[model samples]
Target: MKWIRKIAGMQSSILGINERNLGFIYPNNARKNYKYADDKYLTKNILHSHQIACPLTYAMIDAIGKIEQAWQATCEWNELVIKPSKGAGGKGIMILKKKNDQWFSQSKPVSEQDIFTHIANIIFGIYSFGDSDVALIEEYIRPHDIFYQIFPEGVPDIRVILLKGVPLMGMLRMPTSRSDGKANLHQGGLGIGIDMKTGRLKEAYDGEKHITCHPDTKHPITGLTLPHWDEIIRMSLKAAMKFPLHYLGVDLVIDQRKGPMVMELNVRPGLGIQLANREGLKDAIYRAKQENLLN
Candidate 1:
């Protein structure tokens, strides 16, 4: 009931309320990277500065001046992840796996020339909002085999929603046929509720209501307790404290060997979290407030 009211309150614009709720809310202008909630480059910078756990970034080429060198730099790590710094919703990301001194992508193999061209396009910002975008070459995480067993050839991540530096609610995002290998809820993936107190997964929702099997893999989506759930929640809260924003959604992936790594921070997290939990995020927010999270 609380979640329903919270979800309903958030959509006040549709509720025919002409009067603004300005006092109870802060305007969105003060938030950094508001337009791009999950900018990979900005997320890395925030994580790195705070010394939070994240995938190591090898190189970041933010301007045309550093583009050529970024291309020529032979990555020490054979397998790497290249993605637009400002990209979100799982677009413009490429994973390069090394085999026998040659580079192979998730879908295709590439040569040195191919890598250079790709970097060039990144410098040109072909895959981003504008020509001013940057490209990040980061450590590629071999996701834990347990999750991979469910969604092989894809990375499954957990999304933790934080309100005022407190872990409020969470969901495990699993890739599905509709998402094309992405675990984003809107992209046809599945969202499974995480018990806030126990950190165990409770149920699964497909951006709407309860669902058991993945639409693509046909795999069951419930009853799997996340590894390092408490640690992950602690890390999410700690990471949020480092940022200036009051409300955010932090995504993380657990690597087989690397543990937990921050994926991205979303300033304007989607309302899908409500449906995923089968409860409103508003109730969690109120609970956190009662615990003095605003302080």
Candidate 2:
């Protein structure tokens, strides 16, 4: 009921799917330049060119013949993340750790051939709607300590929405037991609103209802402080300005050692953020425009 009360006055300002596409996405993001954001390898290249921090690429394999050699270069690393460059919804991603010269995923032993097979599957585009894709062997991020106590299983991230290089709203995504360690809100994870100016936490929306504590860890949700808040916004806007897209959703993760690193960029970001923040994008967009007019 409190959550309901919080959003009571914002009903008229909600941004729905249709309005989002026609008003924000289609007009601002060009189809030809979507590759800069849609392809993981290409996104990293853009981030690298602008000196924006992101996960390090160990290798990129586009052909079946090069899979073995590319993966070999990453052998010295204790942990690695393999994913499809054009994958979506967290599909085509594999994380493995090494022990005794063996790789294990989710604590289950997997053979070297199994790793090769997964990489080959990525190259064949099994995850990108049947289009050929590249395999990205990159750095595995261990989230910072602040996230460890919240939920230890998956890597949580922050989503910042920006338009014309101006940041508007922000949300923190955290994993829940039901989400199977995936921080996607639709997959049963939690999306908590953020006080963009103060970097303070607010109520969390778990798809159905508003909750103040983590369902899995029993940790408090509101008023939680996020570390490196400035860096996250700065990098998000940096990438936004650097890209051709005017409207954007910049995703970022706080690495245990590296601080905030850009994870991905989205030209057509979701609207679930309104429920998380108990606010509407319409109002945010208007406010940003007003501010821009004055300055």
Question: Compared with the true structure, what per-residue lDDT tens digits does model 2 show for residues 1-295?
Answer: 3334444545879887778899889998999988888998889998999899999999989999998898778879988888999998778788888999889876689988999999999888899999999999889999999889888877899999998888889999998889878888777889899999888999999977889999988889799989999888899989898889988899999999999999999888888788899889888888888887212
Which candidate has the highest lDDT of all?
A: 2
Cα-based RMSD of candidate 1? 4.6
Deviating ranges (above 4 Å) for candidate 2:
1-10, 293-295
* lDDT (Cα, tens digit) per residue for candidate 1, span 40-154: 7776777888888998888888776776677568465778988888776777777888887778876678987777677667667777755556788888888887677677866
Q: Candidates' TM-scores? A: 0.82, 0.94
Candidate lDDT values, in order = 0.72, 0.88
lDDT of 2: 0.88
Q: What's each prediction's clash count?
A: 1, 0
Q: Supply the global lDDT for candidate 1.
A: 0.72
